[model samples]
Target chain A: MMTYDALSFLLKAVIRFGLYMLLCISIYMLSASLRKKSPVLIVPTFLSVLISGSMFVLYDARGQKSGLDHRAAVRWLCEKPILFTILLFAAAAVLLTYVTFREAHLRRTVPDRSSIKESIDHLPTGLCFYAENGRVMLVNHRMNQLCHIILGRDLQNAALVWDDLCGGSIQPDIMRLSTDSQPRFRLSDGTVWSFSRTQLPDMFQITAVDITQLHNLAQELEQKNIALEELYQRLKVYETDVEVLTRTRERLETKIGIHSELGQTLLATRSYLLDNNENKTIPVEAWKRSIALLRQNIVENAEQFTLQTLIQTATAFGISVEVTGQMPEQKDVEKLFLEAATEALTNAVRHADAKKLHISLTETADTYRICFQNDGKMPETQVTEGGGLGSLRRKAETAGGSMQIDCHPEYSLTISMPKGGTENI
Target chain B: MTRVLIVEDAPMDRQLLELYVKQSGQYELVPSVESAAFAEFCCRTTRVDLILMDVCTSLYANGIDAAEKIKQNFPQIKIIIITGQPECSFIERARKAGVDSFWYKTETAESILHVMERTMAGETVYPESTPPLQFGYITSDELTARELEVLREVVAGESDAAIAEKLYMSLRTVKGHIQSMRDKTGFRNRTELAVRARDCGLIIVDKETE
Candidate 1:
């Protein structure tokens, strides 16, 4: 009976000890779960396990029964139930370390969503975001700045409704579309916009971009092309004028050809007569008459050529020639003077609408001055349109001269040409 | 009157030179020899006072080559180099060959007469616009007349035949002169000689074409 009672008590103690260990293990697991933000209370957990072990040892030693006080069996137990909790916890900690290492490595290599958003915010163009319910979700800094310029207020997409956020009603058709719909809009300021939509299950993502500068640049380029085509037409006209002049020159050259031919023929006849010496009187009289006729013909031809040349030059362009000061004797001086004067006149007639034109020419021994003026408003000076006049000015400078424009409500162009032209031919 | 030996390969240019020389009245004509071999014979026996050498004497060969050979045998022989080229390299080569004077055919008649008078006075006369001394063409004056001739040939981008025709001489004579010039100036080819001459300012290569 004594041994039986001892065995039963020992068994009860064993049960109690097992229940205590289970409770202790449950508490530790709970604490570990709660303490996820910090490291698990390792020191306290180890202390609890130690205390539990000491209590189990004391209780088992005191309550010596067959089940609970089985010292011979429990003393060398490498597989204790309470110790299993520690082993499980150690395995979990190792798994957590490996997971954390891999996550840290990925974070280092790949840019995160927030980091990409930050860069997009720094962009120069406007950018906006809309949510699943078509509400304003998030917008970058660039989009925020543009909102002031466009809507005249700070935009906070607290409510993603276009009418509420934009201070005006959204396009009804565009508002009704799903978040995944990409739509485009052109604003009153000539700004063109493109909105890209992305579907995120419950939420819609819309990125609105402004393409106004690109549209304006395209329009400017189209205008430039039109101007270039007009310029090409003008060049064709100039080519025709050159061809006409060349033909006229050829026609004039034909008449001069006969004079030289006649002179040569008369000389040949004279040589024949001189060799024979038998027919002298007729040959001498013919030679003298031919000589006198040649001189008369030469003088008349020169007078005719000069008269024709003057008429052609005066009537060539829309300009009426007025006698100015004495021009230079240099062969190319007239060419230079006419070119400079023509450019000034063309500008006034074509652009300024000036009907009255006055040109004054004066010359010193070493200098030539020309003043061409019109009571016309100066055209708005554009560098692109100013290239022709600029080239003329450069030509004058090359001839050791100067050019200036005096612009009042009226226009006056003054050009100066030096005597012995520019040194840098 | 100084008895000048006329050495030229072309009939027309030779005649033109004779006319000019006769008009000057400072020089008397001797037998005109056209080849280096004949020039050597004239040099050996004739009482020649001056040698009016056309660089184109070899008929498309270098007159400088023959002049150099003649100079070797008789150092005191007064050599007058006449050419159509205006190059410093040629002037330098002629100076090295110990030529007495140089003249260009395209100069005004008065300049030609002046060069003659100066040369007869036993003064070393060279063109005012001689090339600079870089590839060492100038012994004293910047350029000699002969160097200018070679430079002009090179600048014209002419073959020996073209140069002979332009200067009224033979192709062989021009070639010989160019070869001899190359040997003296250490130039690789006629082109190099021309470029170096222009760079050295022997002739206004840019001005000649214009």
Candidate 2:
């Protein structure tokens, strides 16, 4: 009997512990699913259930071993149900604390709409939005101030703002906005405002900026440009005047040099006419009076100056000379031909006793020739080169040309020199 | 008597020619003209044996042109061109124009009447050379053609290398020419020679003399 009672007590304790374990497992699984929603409550809930179950098992085993009455065992088992209920209530309180904490965390992470509204209100530029229905959805403080300044009145809606700004001057429906956003609005207070709009799904944002300073700067630049153009025109006129003055001065200088040259010729001629041994009848005073008369009728123009001087000088010696063809543009080449002619004329009169002299100028592709032939006495014998003829030959050769002297039927000197485009020497 | 025509632009020069013609006693003064054009017309219209033509006149600058025209028509008239200008330059042109003689007004030692008498007796008279003109330390005629070539570039402010390339000469040759010119001219440097050459217009060769 004692063995049977012992066996029965052991079996009963095992059965009760197994049932408590089942209950613990069920609550654990149920709490695990709810733990994801309020994880902070999971540990406390699990500890309460484990403690209450372990206390019940310890009380029952002690009662049974001490051979306690069934009522005592029953009372010990009853304490387990009260402990379970108390554990359930503690789990409920833990879940409520977790819920409160989560709400506070969400409030910290995401900002409220009021903060965004406050930010837009203090923006530097004017900001406003219009709903798809064309109603004024939101506006900042700057936007209101822009409306008052540009429109000359407070406007409630974007349509009213457009009407006030354009003043029916531009058809808003037909005007291309984004591609041509340069149209600006001038306020009554002389301030300039440039507006732009961006379209969104529910509404469109409009922005405006004061551009009065920029407009003033552009106007100032344009005015300066006009002034600069006028100054440039004035400078061009002054440059032209300077060029004319320089040309006139050059002409005057050439004339003065020529006059001085003429004066010297007159003095020389007076000495020559007075030195005539055969003309003892002509007084020196008479020649001086004649030379004085020659200075008064000189040509003043520069174009005819040199030619005129030559013509007059040749007339004094009874040399009837004529020139044809365009004058050489290069002064040096022209001088070469003129010098050779003088030498030939000298030989004709001094040596050959020639009376008539004929000079002809002809030009080829590479050379210009001055042919000097006179109706003078041909040499009785072969003529040798003298100081004058030798010098003439050298001049022609040095200039890359040649000189030919003919002493046959006619006394002639033909000098051919290189034309223009000669190397600068 | 020899019929003389005086074409002089200057009043004094014409009177001087008139006085010379009257004093010669062998020639009679024709109507004196102040222009080559009037002289040409006179030679065409009237009998003129001798024409005393100043190279420059009021109507036409070059008496050589008038002389050529007159000689083409009347091959019998004698023309003498007288001027104080550098005879070196005008001699060839006067010779080609069929002038009988050329006389330097200031430099000629011979009497104008004697040259006129010789020209009438079928004589062609011209001076030996131009009056001597000095540039720097050398005479104008002393500058050789090659020296003048180097001097032009120096006056134009070109470097030796640039001158060599332009003239198709070596750098050493260009420098040699410059140095030679400086030595011959007694100039201290290239700049002095160049400036004097420019002032005197001595470097007359342009391109063909190269």
Candidate 3:
């Protein structure tokens, strides 16, 4: 009887534990359904709660009726074994279905480990995180592909890959973006990428961003700048042409005016000459004016003022210019020499009434010297700097040269200029 | 006989044209004037059959402008625009002005009387081209348009830097043009090049100074 009583207590304890497990599972399902707002879990939770509550109530009534005798409850369960076995089988089936549905729901909603890795692998840019020991922590597919191209292997050590990129020992297919300190490279397909690194708390992160479009735009802009420069040059040439045409028109107008004046004067002379009346005179003033105009036109139309022209003019004035030694090959020096000779010719003719003018040219290592001496009378008084001499002196000084006039012991003028020093003039 | 009116600023050219009209014997000479301003009035008062107009007339009257007005008013009166200056846009302006014939005083090989006769004979007479002038070792026609532009600035006494700035070219480019011109002309220096160019009347600058 004691053994029966012990067995009854054990069975009661086993039943209570099973009921407690059912109650806990039901409550958990209820709370989980409420949180997720899942109507599918509601039926399963209600069934579990009802079964556990009814069983608990039946056991308690049997225990109270028998006055703490566990043997009566044992005998009660033994008599309805078939009914208890059916109920137990039904509860086990319900629990199995609920557990299976819950597992499927979790699989559909939650991301798996492989899926998370797939997302990181498909990123556009190259990304890698590495530890201090050069161990690759997290590397994407793009980075591994870049490593294969650069290092000829999959990414094992990200720090080594970064070192290879920075060392600039890559293949000819890769070109450096610029001479700047930034690490940027251009691939063979015209794709430009800029690589950069950042230090995290315990790791290092390296990234390569695509910059092809910006590089192409910069190249296009450079080409346009060159074209604009060419267009600006063309416009400038047109402007200068217009300016020249305008000036030419003005000169033609002046010439036409002079020609018209001369024609009018000729006509006046003809009319005066053909006049049959004795009241008309010769019009001497008009004739003189016409002659003056003709002379002015002739002088204006004379050859340009060069050394040859100057010499011809001096000869026309009954003064012969005797040039000795070779003239300097430099244009500016030759021009200055001719100017001084002209001044000497004018001074000799106007002031001293000379006939022969001699010009001597000589060159030293660094200076060109020209001396103008005329066979004219000596100056009666000390010669001062007048308009012509003063102007010549100013010009000479401006050209980085010097001019001197010696009045005594025959009149001679010497001017010296340094070679290659008169370019601005 | 065609009655003609002469409009010329210069008395010599006007007298010459008057003599040509009188000597033609086929044309009758009307009154002559010194300016194109009197051309329309002369046409209005007289029975004018044709008009000989000069491009640059006295009183600042442009003959082309006057000719355009006359053509609009009396299109029947045949007009011939004559000019001595080759640098001016007289030919183009005269054509746009609807003048009957154009004659260059110095450049045209044909006589002005021939041009007038052609116009009276219902022929549109125009020269093939302007007369080519000798400039240094090359003719004016031989110079490229760009080279001519640079030459004009050089003749204007502009420095290389100034010319480069004005023409929107580099300093080296201006120097290059000058050097090319020198090589073509075989001139010794820039001063000689400028002086010879001016003397040849290829490029005329303002003031006409040395």
Best by DockQ: 2
Q: Which model is ahead, 2 or 3, in terms of lDDT?
A: 3
Off-target runs (Cα >4 Å) in candidate 3 are A1-116, A179-181, A260-425, B1-210
Residue B144 error, candidate 1, Å: 30
lDDT (C-alpha) at residue B59 in model 1: 19
Poorest 10 consecutive residues of model 3 chain A by lDDT? A296-305
Q: What share of the true interface contacts does each candidate keep?
A: 0.00, 0.03, 0.00
- State each candidate's clash count: 34, 81, 0
Better of 2 and 3 by TM-score: 3
Give each model a TM-score. Answer: 0.27, 0.31, 0.34
lDDT of residue B12 for candidate 3: 50
lDDT of 2 at A327: 50
Give per-residue lDDT, candidate 2, residue A399: 68
What tens-digit string does per-residue lDDT give for candidate 1 at A47-80? 4455455545544554554455555545433224
Off by over 4 Å in 2: A1-425, B107-110, B144-210
Instruction: List candidate 1 segments past 4 Å from native.
Output: A1-93, A105-125, A129-134, A154-227, A262-425, B1-210
Lowest lDDT block of 10, candidate 1 chain A: A299-308
Per-candidate DockQ vs. reference: 0.01, 0.04, 0.02
What lDDT does candidate 2 reach at residue A227?
Answer: 100
